[model samples]
Target: MIEIVARNGSPEAMLCPAFICDACRKQVMEAGNVIYAVRYPDQSERETSPLFVAHKGACDMAVQQWLAANYPVADGWSDLWDEIDDFLAYLGGNFKRSFAEDADGQYVPHVVVMPATSPKLP
Candidate 1:
């Protein structure tokens, strides 16, 4: 999961997490990158599953192909096109608004972990 937070000493600037693309093995640094969570049949008992983060164009396509080939159910996969700034707004915490502070008064970044599968998928 990627953590989106306001940069230290610069509330107007956001510090976004960078992930390595599972398909292309390249770093995905931008806000609009894609993230995929895949769950296999035998690994259901695990609490935290693996995640695949990739760039928008070719890397995302490659991830799609890999998921399709490995997990044919389609229901076993969940993906999101992450837009950091917009998501922060939706969470009621943007760069302008103050983030939630911990007991130590440290700013808490918004962290979302999507489920690997949804019942709505066919």
Candidate 2:
């Protein structure tokens, strides 16, 4: 679903599950390559969200032209540099799966063998 987010009293486009720029019809992989465009919602009663992602260098002209033809107000559209790999650090931990060599020389799940003297065993 497309959601329009407002930042600093200005509308920002938030494209979810879609990296394609709506303005230039190109993929927006890096966050630093985004130019947000805000306009009035097409629906009157229903709330709408930002639905476009334009490239910074390639879509600059296209975004500007679209904004000029659609929204003449200064606050209608804005550009922002975003971090593309911001979420890459979400899983920060030193965890590794225990594996054992199988007959085929392939890694397999390691079984924890406890001694009979251990209290964990019956």
Q: Model 1, stretches more than 4 Å misplaced?
A: 1-17, 37-49, 74-122
The alpha-carbon lDDT assigned to residue 35 of candidate 2 equals: 33
Candidate with best lDDT? 1
Model 1 TM-score, all chains together: 0.39
On residues 58-101, what C-alpha lDDT tens digit does candidate 2 reach at each position? Answer: 46556545534443456343333333343223212212322352
Residue pairs whose backbone atoms clash in candidate 1? none
Task: Check candidate 2 and list the clashing pairs.
Answer: 4-49, 4-50, 21-53
Clashes of each: 0, 3
Summing lDDT over every window of 10 consecutive residues in candidate 2, give the lowest-scoring window: 113-122
Q: Whole-model Cα lDDT per candidate?
A: 0.48, 0.39
lDDT of 2: 0.39
